[model samples]
Target: MKKLLAFIFLISSFAQAQYTINGTMAPILESDWVILYKIEGASQKYVQDSKIKINTIDVQGKKQKIGTFSFTLPKDTEAGSYRVTYKLENAGYVDFIFNKENLNFGFHPDYPEQTVTFSISKENILYRKYLEKISNAQQQLDSIQITALQNPSLDLKSAYQTSLNKVNSIQNEYLTNSKDMYVAPFIKANSRNNPSEILDNPQTYMSNIIDTFFYDVDFTNKTLLNSSFLIDKITDYIFYINYSDDPNTQQILFKNSVDKVIYKFKNIPYKKSIIEFLIDQFETTMNLELIDYLFENHYYKLPKTIQDQKYITSKRALFATGIGRVAPDFSWIENGKNFKLSTLNDSEKYVLVFWSTTCSHCLNEVPKLHSFLKENKAVEVIAFALEDDEFGWKNYKTNLPNWHHVLGLKKWQNKIARTYNINATPTYFILDKDKKIIAKPESLEDVKTFINKQ
Candidate 1:
């Protein structure tokens, strides 16, 4: 009876063991709290958030406020990858592995990835070492391979062989040590396929790399699917593998890479997630052509549940006003006659300027712009003055008589201004003879530069 009781007690104790994650941020700046999240696939599951406790510490004869926050994980917490986000700007967050172990780390908020250091986490410490050592070895191998390819006469076979051996050894060692831990799948998935022998031809070497890029990765692994590995891997494959000097050729390469990447995944949700990520990436860079291609080729084909029609409509609206698309049409009353923008066929190009009479910057730049365009005949300027009332605009338009002027009441709430998605005063859009938007200049200088180039 006594022995049975002792065994049961030991089992219970092990089951109830709790884990903790403690974080410290130096020079916390304006951030007052931190949120902890469990990263799963393309999303983050919010676990908890904590208010930071500031402590003033003297460093190098100067006082600094160091911020500290912590999260106590329940005994049954799922083990995998976790993220702590302090701020949203410039990716102010740190990712670490958690496997029923306590983690204590510190980092500078501005440079979290570069400066994060762990003090008391076995899983994280080993993972950090593995990344550093493996990355160094791989870089050395790449350098030697590139050098040998560049100078075929140079004898770099020995150096290349050594670097390859080092990479293999480091990878194998980490795989072995982390087999029972949460980081094993990450290490295995991150392994690169290296050539056994050096090749003299750059084209052949690159071809071999591209062929074997996804050989070591297991797309079906649940752990990999639940973490950021798959997305990161897909991103690397799509954007980093193919390069071309010609813009058109580069775009074709990108499409090919996307096809290759999408073909690797069998899960529908995963595929949808990757497509969404790609759309966001291209949208940020203002690559409307690629965005259109993705929507027509991939995004629109997905099932309705994952289609997100609202998001699709918003994206379409965004593209409607983009640089290759036709500008939205508007009309105004001039001398008891209604005139439409699309009906104007007077000039080879048109400049649409959205400005407010009350805006100081607009008041300053519009006059300068009028003077600059006085000598140019091929381009016609149409100025839309967004205002709450026409009193200020009527007084201001007398000086600039060369350009066609339209008074837009309600200022920011004006329909014409909203149609163009105007958020700031003095916004400029240059349209071609076909009424397609050719360029959206940032400032008066940009407008001058565009006209001068044409």
Candidate 2:
């Protein structure tokens, strides 16, 4: 009976075991809370969240406030990469390996990833050391190779060989040591492909580097996908490797590199995730042409289940308002007669100005615009006023009788405002005779400059 009871106790203890992640931020973080997430393929699953506690501490004989937070993992938590996001602005977060082990670390909020110091967790510590050593070795090799290419007469074969040997030695040691570990795949995927022989020609060396960039990467590795490694690798290849002085040439190079990247992945889900990431990157730069290319070529080809229909519609709406595309049609009642923006043939050029009575800037600029366009008979001004009520607009429009006036109720929630994606008042869109957008002016002065130039 005693032996049986002891075995039962052991099993109970094992089943009840839980891990914890404790974080410390010096010069106290601005955020009041921190959230923990388990990183899966292309998304993060919420694990837990904690309210941060601030405490004063001594740092080199000076008092400093530090923020601390902790997250206790559930007993059945899976082993993989985890993220702690303390704040949303400026990407205030840190990612680390969690393999059913307690982790303790500290970092500065401003530079979380760069300033992080691990006090515990063998996996994180080992991974950090491996990255530092390998990065140093690779930098040395690159420096030597660049020097050799720059000065062809000077022999750098011995230096290049020494640096290359160091990189290989570090890579092999980490690969062997991290065997069967969660971080093993990351180290393997991050291995640099060094040239076997030094090439005097820069073009040849660059070509070789680009060709072997993805030699060690396994696109289907779940662990790598869950982390930021694959996204980072793809970003470097598409943006950094492919460059040109001319903007048109750069766009073509980017497209070619994107093709090479997409061809490497056979898994549909992984491919979709990568393409989505690329779309987001281009969206930030407002590269509408590339965005259209991605949707037409890659995103549209994906399965319907993965396709985001709402996002597709929104993007199409944006394209509809783009320069050279006909503006969305809208109708309004003026003098008890319906008038449509598309059917207006009375003027050679139309100025669509979205303004609000409550906006101080709009109040200041609209009068100036009305005065300036009074003498210009060829240009017709469509003053669309976004308002909550007709009281102020009815009284305000008396002074600008020559301009066609349209009232948009519901202010920002107005259909026309939403259609144009208007966030601020006094926004101007200059349209040609065909009602196609020509110039999106910033101010009344810009409107004058554009009209005067024409």
| Top candidate when judged by TM-score against the true structure | 2
Candidate 2, 134-154: lDDT as tens digits = 998899899989988889998
Clash pairs, candidate 1, are: 41-226
Question: What ranges in model 2 sit over 4 Å off?
Answer: 1-16, 322-326, 329-350, 356-364, 376-379, 385-398, 401-415, 432-454
**Tens digit per residue, CA lDDT, model 1, 20-114:** 78999998768878899898878789999999999999999999999999998888899888889888776588998888889999998888888
In candidate 1, clashing pairs total 1
Clashes of each: 1, 0
Give the Å error, residue 131, model 2. Answer: 0.5
For model 1, the run of ten residues with the poorest summed lDDT: 311-320
